[model samples]
Target chain A: MTVSLDLSDVTAHYGNTKVLEDLSLHVAEGELVSLLGASGCGKTTTLRLVAGFLEPTSGRIKLGETDLTRLPAHSRDIGLVFQTYALFPHLSVRDNVAFGLKQRGEGRAARQRKADEMIERVGLAGFADRFQANLSGGQRQRVALARALVIEPRLLMFDEPLSNLDAKLRVDMRVEIRRLQQINGTTALYVTHDQEEAFSISDRVAIMNAGRIMQLDTPEVLYSRPANLFVADFVGFENVIPMRAVAEAGDAVRAEIEGGGMIDLPKQHYTVPAQEFVLASRPEGLLVDTADRTDGLPAKLGLRTYLGRAYQYQCDTTAGPVKANGPLGTPREEGEIVTLIPQPEQCCLLPREAK
Target chain B: MQRRAHPALIAFAVLTFLFLIGPLVIIVGAALSDTSYLTFPPQGLTLHWFQNVFEISAFKRTMITSFQLAVGGTALSMAIGIPAAYAMARYRIELPRFLGNVFVLPILVPEIVLGFSLMKSVAVGSGVPIMGALLLGHALLVLPYCVRVVGASLNSFDFSIEEAAVSLGCPRWKAFFTVVLPNVKPGIIAGFILAFITSLNDVSISIFLTGPGVSTLPIQLLAHMEQFFDPTIASVSVLLMFVTVAVMAIVERTLGLTFLTK
Candidate 1:
């Protein structure tokens, strides 16, 4: 059965330093939500709060209709897969997977059967009799997942589960984890500092900075339309140029850029009194043309790198150094002058305070 | 095809090994002598002094006392040390550095000073019985070993396993018993053996605490040696050594001695 998790206006502190401030999130039933942020940005703390390892200073945590804010970790009926795997070193893989079931006083035969099935599901069938010390990093990670899932918990949580893995195994394990979660229809909260890993497996990613969620949306939406300058820059929007709004239309506003140029931006996409604002766009959103063009900004190319699939060019423009990607077939020289044009729909307008 | 070790290094290593264990060999040789006086390279080999050890009534009583003290002290120390070490290792106890130094202060103090301090505080000042004083002293003496060994074990332990158990529907205490205890068992066993040995072989502390009708084996042996110089003491020492070795072998068979070295 699937269960939803909700945390509303939660605030947590360690002594006098506030680690999480008024943080809130909701994970729909059977959906995987990842809290992605840099280290010490309170992503792990939020996961721990949901897993009952921490008690929020002021907030309400609910699973379906039941309140779990004050419940102890054991009574919460949640499963957590730690980054270190944290397998019981003294027990074999089978017993480690059966630990949660055994704690619930299940019969030995029942535990063995459930543990065996889960172990096979996690692709650790032959590792049942071996201790954790004998297994490789990937095998140990699978054991941790099986141990957490075998109990049929209401909610599942992971704290950087694949961080210890090698690059190749990390990709494989990410797919396996997502597949298992979907098949089981379990509500899960994953925490990781790696943005690519988070975007790969999570149904939706929440970008966090300074203990607050900057944006919560699908990975595609987050990449295309970021809410603020922080989310824009974090999600690879490298070109952020300051703009001044000259006039407002029905839904769009004409903004004056540096070097005597103008661009029309949708008013609904940014905050209102736009005295000082910034136009943000990803490198892929900008098109570079070596031939002279009247409708685009003039710039000199600095460095051009071949990224296997596309050519990345760095241009020295009035807005500073703007990076753009183009097709590999057309090679542009370093000192050549080029016209850089921004695709209107792919760019975002944000208030100056967001900086 | 392998390269040979230098002759001077080999000779130095042999000399170091002999320097460490040469006295034990002499004691065992003297224990097997049939002569009345203690002598190495005996004229005749016999087990006569071992039997003579059993004939003395005081030796038998003191041997029982020493066994009780070692066992009781080790058990008490473990009971007190596990929780102390766990708190120091896991919780953010206030004044942690100061508390750690206090817990291990017994090992740093000279044995003679510790014995005198215990005699003044627990035996004379508190007016406790001689046996109680000895038991308390031994417990204090061995407590540092338990804390240090168990603390080291807890340091390498991954605390998330305990958290996982708790999340899997086990209470905090049950999680500790099921997960933490089993993981740190090797250290527990090693600490118990070390504490037992330390309590068993204590002479300086036992000498000041021993009174009439209550004395440890080492104190009794020392008293016997003051007047008589014979091979009986050597035989007793060899027996004690055998008991220690037998205990160590049992430990090595069950939970390897690598934990003890750690």
Candidate 2:
């Protein structure tokens, strides 16, 4: 049966070192939510806490209405797919898949039947009798997935499960995992350091830093309107320039870049921060205006990199070093003077960063 | 370019090899001597001394007792040390480095001193039976190998697989039995074999603890040497040397000899 996972104000530590600090999350039933962050950003710790491997120093974890704060992992009815696949090397595919059933006292004949059915479903029908040592990397992961899913656990968790797969296989395997989870309608929490993987697979993504989640929202909103500079920067916002509002009209806002430029943006396209704010954009969003010093921030180009679709310019601005995309049709040479125009459609105005 | 050794260095290396393996070659050769007494060169080859080891009824009983102690002691050491090593390897204990050092500390004590201490504490002072006391001593003597070898195996194991079992609805301890135990089988078997050999060949510990009727095979061999200097003991040693080599080869094939270093 499916159950929602709720982690409320959980704080955890390793001896004196704090890992997750008063973190709270609620994953809706049948929904897949991803915890996205760099390595050691406490994403794995959060998954471990949910799986009942690590107890929280404070607060509670709930699966549906069940209080799981002190539940052992096996009793929690949660499945975890590790990056290593973690398949039992000694057991054949059938036995490995049937292990959970056997432990819960399922009869031998019954469990074997169920395990065989699952082996076939995961595309390893004839290979059930083969040992893990005989399987390829993809086949091994498929076994791991089938073993976790066959239990029909209340919640399924993935800890960078696709990180070990090559790029092409990673895409295919993620699709496979997502298909099975959908067929079962099990709530899942996925932890990954890859932004693309999270954005593509999850219904919503939580970007974490240190121990706190900076923002949790749909991938679209997180990409377009991140709540703060950190979240903005995490979603490919390469330039963050502080700006003060000079004037405002009904559908337009005129702002002055901190250094030496003026810009006008559509009011509906970007958030008008109540006070002085920071403007963030991706390299593609921060386009180099061909004009030298009009309608944008003044910059001097340092280095140019030819991206397949565009030539990216590393330009020095009074704000800091800024990377912006210049049109390949009219490439800018190094040491050339340029101006940067921020496209509100690809930009967001964030409140000052919280310390 | 490979460097060449000097003439003096080559001569010194040859002497060292002879010094190390010289006694073993002499014993193997003497075991085949036609003469009844144990003598090396100038003797016609015969297999009579090899057959003599199987003739003595007293020697048979001692061999039985020695085999029993080796099997029983190795079993007890594994029963205690596998779980203990698992704890030391898998969990974060207080002063883990210090605890690891203490776990393998039994090997640091001289075998003779350990034997005397065992006899004093277990047999005489503690009022234990002779066979029980000897078994306990052997188990204690081989515990370090059990811990070291099994601990090395457990250390290199991917603990995540254990967690995977736990996640798959296996109880924590049951997970250890089904998952952890089977994966580290090579190390466990290697450890058991090593401990078995140590118990089988133990002399100093057996000497201190042997009462009237409870001497081990090695103690009986020592007694036989005192009565007659025959090639019978040499034949037994050769057989044991071959057994030890076979066991070592099996361990090397299965777990790789580098596990000992681990």
Candidate 3:
């Protein structure tokens, strides 16, 4: 049940304008990889390329030993769950699930057995005779997933699978999809713009921008150690401070921060460059007005509001307005001078790339 | 709500309806006339002209020819138009914008011009006979309307459904037949009926391409009207009206007229 996909230097274009460019990533056996990006970032195009719906402008797509670049979509043996959950409006739930099996020329009983098995797997056993128009949105999505996965394809792809659902249903369905993928041990690729959805379900998440993969890593690493500014910004790093590299006498390099503030770069923690770089920090990594915290930088708090178990403060710092989330009971007022300290280990240094 | 009618508006509406229905009512009335001449008011009400129309072999032959041509023309148009519409809908092929214009340009050309063009192209260049020439002409004339209707339908269709099917291991052709074609059937059906009726009632192109012993019903009716001023042609006209109305009613029943307007 192991499946590995290799997309090497893939580029896709719509006429003269390129949609995906030199995109490359790999999903190990039975791993769920998510391509997370904003709209028009070529995430769907990459999924389509892997599914063989679109021919790459120039590249190779290898699934284990088979090169699927030239293969048609059906021959690629990849399952795709569409964003709209495109179930056949005319077919019964059972017939929709049986479509692929019948296409393979399976006998009547065999097809019905497989369809019934898949229907139960998706928790729609009793609704097999129901038409798609009679089902709810969640049930329709589950049926679409069953139709895609019933064939046991080499690769499974979901195109914004949970985007159409409400917030609560999205959370529940994403967990269910992840559980099903893991239980079946299927190699899956999930495309979505929701950062929380990508982080929650993916073993590895690839952040894309302008037809290129900016970074690919586990969710924890992507959040704490994004490779560039795009991935940092996309992964919810609210503050990206501008820094110029300076010489360190011994253990640390002195980096000149923007707005006349300076911070010593711990050589072990950061990737120091020769000239200039940017330091990225997530909102949760910044600590404000704590007695035991070291490296406290002076900042003016603008607004303070309680967010569940945390206090969200908008502070005007050397790096513009920084949004920092602190512990719920922390005392802070608007227009009050406070010292905000960022965790040294959690701060990510990225080489500057043009917007 | 009170149902009060404005006298002027009511009069205008009645006049418009009469203006539209006057010719058909007069023709139907003449079809039942006992007189040999076609007159607005019948001297005697009878079914004699209908019997005359039925007894004539020319009328029967022409009706059969028209039915065959219309059916063949519709099938041929569907064979070419459906796939062309699908391709235009899915793929960003080269010159599709231009191809669309080329497909619809035939409709803009007058039927007389199309008739002459078909005659010079097929009748002279390839040396096809009268049947071949008539079919070729009708297919060409009706193809653009089919493409326009079917293409409009395909435009509104969801492309993702076909992709979903293909990814489920159904081949592209199977996916098209199962997912795409079934969804677009309403439009295809409307286009089929429209093309059929257009071919059936066509006189300009049919008259030019059809040789001796191969006249269509409209051409036969025109020939009868010119040679003899009789109510028999009016009876034939009423029969043709029935055929057109029946075909239109079937189309409206099957696909709904809303498909046409959309």
lDDT per residue (tens digit) for residues A221-245 in model 3: 9877877777778877778777787
True contacts kept of each: 0.81, 0.83, 0.76
> Model 3: residues >4 Å from true position, as ranges?
A244-256, A262-276, A290-294, A303-311, A325-334, A344-346, A351-355, B1-5, B92-94, B124-126
lDDT of 3 at B39: 89
TM-score of 3: 0.92
The candidate 1 chain A region of ten consecutive residues with least summed lDDT is A264-273
Per-model TM against the reference: 0.93, 0.92, 0.92
Report lDDT (Cα) of residue A115, candidate 3: 93
Which parts of model 2 are misplaced by more than 4 Å? Answer: A249-251, A290-295, A333-338, B1-22, B32-36, B42-57, B92-95, B242-262
Per-residue lDDT value at B89 in model 2: 88
Q: What DockQ results do all the predictions give, each relative to the true complex?
A: 0.80, 0.79, 0.64
Q: What do the candidate models score in CA lDDT, each in turn?
A: 0.88, 0.89, 0.85
Give a tens-digit lDDT track for model 1, residues A1-355. Answer: 7889999999998778799999889999999999999998999999888878888999999998889999888998898999999999999999999999998899999999999999999998787999988999999999999999999999999999999999999999999999988888999999999989999999999999989999999998897888888899998888877778788766867667765666555555554446778778888777787646643556788888988988889888776788887777788888888877767667777777742
Interface RMSD, every prediction, one decimal place: 0.8, 0.8, 1.1
lDDT value, residue B201 of candidate 1: 90
Residue B179, model 2: Cα distance from true site in angstroms: 1.1
Which has the greatest TM-score?
1
Q: What's model 2's lDDT at B138?
A: 90
DockQ: the better of candidates 2 and 3 = 2
